[model samples]
Target: MDTPQNTALTRALTELPGPLPARGVIHIVIPHTDRFTVVGNHLAQHAGLSTVAVGLAVRIQSLPQGTEIGIKALAARFPEGEKLIAAALRELEAHGYLRRAVTNLPNGRIVTRTVFCNQPTALLRPRVVAQRPAPPQTSPPAQDPAPEPPAPEAAAAPQAPALPDVQQEQEPEAPAPLEQEPEAPAPAPQDHAPFVARVPPPTAPRQPPPPLPQPRELTAELDRAATALLSDLRRHARQLVLSENDIRQLAPAVAAWLERDTHPDTIRHTLTNDLPQPLRHPAKLLKHRLTVLLPPPLPGADDLAAPARPRIAVTPFQTCDGCERAFRAPTPGHCRDCRNAHAHGPAQAAA
Candidate 1:
């Protein structure tokens, strides 16, 4: 029988004395009766995932179906910026905790479908069912036939005369065993060589794209213009900041564009407009754009001849001295009628 003092002493030893020590995390879990989400240890204690990714995954799981979990929405709700949120989402996707797929609807609308997996490992691994050995088949024991009823007692019959015992006279000797023939030795098995698979010859390596065309002659003015344009690209778009080496390497390509009558503004717009987010290789992108969007050289004047226009001469107006009459003449002089009258007057006077 246990005493009260012993029981009390045992309880005191097992129970904690005061507040818990500040060491690692200690849970005082209170079960939620309603509105509780179940999180697996795979996600909560994953070694590969960052804390942000783990928290983001949990938040996504707790939300109701069809809720917006886009980068912008998450960024608005949480303190993290869009870049960090996007990075966390990518991490989750890489580790199989989340999946996003684009689907096109019949009505021509595109939508993204998101799926969250609680146990990614379990989902990925294949399930196996163990097969048990079958029990040995047994047959039922056979029963003996029922004993026949005892037959009536039969009458005694006379015994026949006794014959001489074969054993007592002479036992016939057992026949001699037949002589056994010697067995022939078996032939040895032949060793089979392993099959050698013939490998096909390696295919030719893929060729890289051709280099961008450069200007025939890089003049000082053209070089300065191209360099200035490339250096100023960062003002329009921050992501397009190019280094000195990049500017130098790409100056010739830009000079080619300038030589072909392509404006600096047009080049800048082509490089900076509608850029993809998180541009990784700015130099390579600019190089490709410069090559593809290069303008054709201006046509020569001789090749594109303009049509000749006809010329019309305009006469000047003059006022006659004798009469105030306006007439078209080369110089300031009398009208045609006035001149004819003067000539006739002189002839009349002479006559």
Candidate 2:
């Protein structure tokens, strides 16, 4: 059926040239209803519908009925944004191509509904009509049940048999047996007075519990390590400043390093190495270093008590070029294992 909208769109489309020469190698189909064509073509010459507005209008006109056609939805599908879409909608309304009615539903909620039309009209604004609820349906009166037929008469009853006559009995029922009167129960004995409990003598008062041992104070060794770490940090970064709170926070991380048997020199080197040119956050830097580079724990006393074994000195050992493992070597070269593997290639099979 050609609605007013379809009629307007068809008239508008028919005015355009039949078919253009192939403009591009890839052509996409423009899917739209008859009404869409009418509305879109009518807006083609519209001064208010700029390039952006026209695009927004086309997107809105092509959407399926009941699909959300809001500024955000339009902006997502088309490059034109909420502002352009809003302007185009207003223009369409002014030109009689679109109508938006503010309606109050039966629930008393007010909402604006937009209606798109291809044909321009001078009709008045749409109004909200309060829906009148339908009247309750009355069930048809139940039909009276049909009358039942009368029942047949019942059969006649039989006559009862008669008993034989007996001689006069002189023996009387033992003089009407006399009913005996029951005697009231004797009164219960009165309860005896409650016995009094004997009281005991008072006992000695409780003594205070022995005083708990005082917690051990911070060790001198831990204090020294924390002080040394702070001093080294300040010396390395002259611009860095340490507050009392910062020192208090850094104490724990330093104590953790000490407990792990980390040497003071090693701790200083780890914390001072690779520091940013301008140290902005000293506490944070120290915290990261202490946590990330924490040394392993010390060996137990039993390990130290055992006999010592011969080991290569640090000066004689160097890292292997290929494997990066530390070993005693006279000069720079690959480790023996890596050398042997490299020599035995796939071409040199076992003989």
Candidate 3:
């Protein structure tokens, strides 16, 4: 049933490097000489990790040191939503592939440091060593003795005293004069005041607050509202007039605030209230407010409660055809009063 072309194709496929397997994952891998990531089978095929977590782990490992991998940064970089990415991060943490430490900096700022472990088991095991016997102690090498000094000259030596005549009587030498001892001066008056040491109180270590909840993705309607709100900030506060580029740059941050059920009025009040005097760099100030004061997402309804109903859209305003009165209706038509008059007029004429 095989033709000449098919036979050649099959032969070519068999000749290729890393022969194809009968089932599951055929790899025709080329050895990478430069940029590539090395992942262990335990991680790549981990039963505990979801596909997103595994891929995220590998990508994180390949990145250079000091790169930002925060929830916000990762959410912006990848197509995955923040909630899913957050869940994936939790999974990686549970598996011992990632660890996050919160530390209070000396400058009173709290920072989070993330550490990734390539070999989790190796981190837990204690190291072993083979002790070798100490080398035998040895004395230092000795140096040659210096030559002896030349003998002292005879002139430097003093002659011995002549002996006194044995027969002559020796008078007792006058007693040497007794020396007087010097007297000690009286001690200076001492102050009786008690000394008190002033020691400063010990400063308490600052504890980092609980982590803020991750923000949700903004919907299309919410994005438009956020952009409009930012563009209109100038009307509320003269100092907050922002350029097109600045608005575009800051729109996402504003959208994050709106995504959390915060009202437009509240946001406007927050940004415009108590602005600094001589405010320079309006864009930067607004950006700081948007980030530092972001509110948490609204809580979901209880499981036992019924789902909230969808909101009905308001009808568009239209002028009635019969009567020139503006009214709320989906389509142009006669107003209620006009319709009633017309209907009754025809019936009353017949009566």
Candidate 4:
């Protein structure tokens, strides 16, 4: 449960005066609207202010400690036109959503950071739900055993002649037979070495594993598409230096793109998995892409085995331990405050 002070604080944050724009209409974030339409200094202020408010409140509500609020994330969430946001920013500055501001340039747009002074109400705790045990069930009482089944009526017994008991007894008494000898046990087989086991001699010549099965090749359309992909790859490979995987994506796609008989998903898998080298070589750019992004080999294909890439430099950014804040790197490989905080982790800083 939140303390009374915290609850009061959560309630105090106000909603914007009027109803917000209707859901599903063109807002800046949706791709449909021309992103650059908002013009003039006044409209720009509205665009900036409205968009900033949306960015600031939501960002504070979702803020991660020690991380900066990036402009791209804010722009992505903006509902109003950006130029209108610029105009609204002045109003917000007069009101109080943003305080001391800083900004950066991205994709040619100047983006500002709105440093938060207080936590937003949206971050407040939600009501808790309690779990309860289920009720027990009862069954009906036991009953007496069922009655026994009826028996069949017996037939009259047949009469037999009395006779030969004396003769039968005399015949049995004539002799007692001797018992037969028991059979001998069979010999045990010798054991082989622990590691030795009979294995078949090599049957087929060594080769790469067969490619993963493709979509039904029985269809005429699949054959046509396969041919096209092979041709495209040949063109692509001869002209460009594909790494091999890219060629695979193109090959199956040709079949998929041309074959009305195949589903897009199946075509995609075929193109990506068992595409022929003839088509693959021409699309060297794709091979380069796949080589970089996917280092592992495709099923039943060559190991790809590209060489190790050059190392990249990562410059450290400044961090404020007191408030758990990190600003973008203004310089390379050093964060002054985090280093100076006197709370250095046991591990020594890199030389």
Name the top lDDT candidate. 1
Q: After superposition, how far is residue 220 of candidate 3 from its true place, in Å?
A: 83
Each candidate's TM vs. the true structure? 0.32, 0.24, 0.35, 0.17
Residue 247, model 1: lDDT of 97
* Over 4 Å off, model 3: 1-19, 129-351
**Greater-lDDT candidate between 2 and 4:** 2
Residues 1-351, model 4: lDDT tens digits:
555566543443333344334344422232445423322343234444555554444444455564543444444555556555555444445645445455657767765556553322222435334334344454877898997765443334454566866544444465667866655545433332234435878899798533323343436756555544454443423434444454455454344344334444443343355444334233543433333332222334244566579998776666654555776675433346665654466445542
The sequence of per-residue lDDT tens digits that candidate 3 reaches over residues 1-351 is 355566766666677875355456544455899999889998999998999999999988998899898888989988988998899899999999999999999999999999988768556555544345555576997988997775577556887777687556799999999977755655544333334456767798887643322336767887688789998999999999999999877777777777777899999998898887658789878877887788877777685589889999999998878879998888888888888999999999999
Ranking according to lDDT, highest score first:
1, 3, 2, 4
lDDT of 2 by residue, 1-351 (tens): 555566755665556554533344333346776654345454666775566656556666677787766667766876766887888777766767677889989999998787876545323434344455555576998999998765453234554555467555688668877867755555544343334445766687887533312113447778677766776677765644678787777776787777666778788778777777546677777777777677767789897797978886664777888999887787878888888878886548754
Cα RMSD (Å) between model 4 and the true structure? 43.7
Judging by lDDT, tell me the better candidate of 2 and 3: 3
Per-residue CA lDDT of model 1 for 1-351, tens digit only, reads 455567655565447455554456544445799998999987999999999999999999999998899999999999999999999999999999889999999999999988888778666544544445455576988999998875454334545666766434578899999977755545433233334556877798987866886998999999999999999999999999899999999999999999988888888899999887658789999999988877889999987998778888989999998787999998998999999999999999999
Ranking by TM-score: 3, 1, 2, 4
**Considering every candidate listed, which one attains the maximal TM-score?**
3
RMSD value for candidate 3: 34.3
TM-score, structure 1 vs. true: 0.32
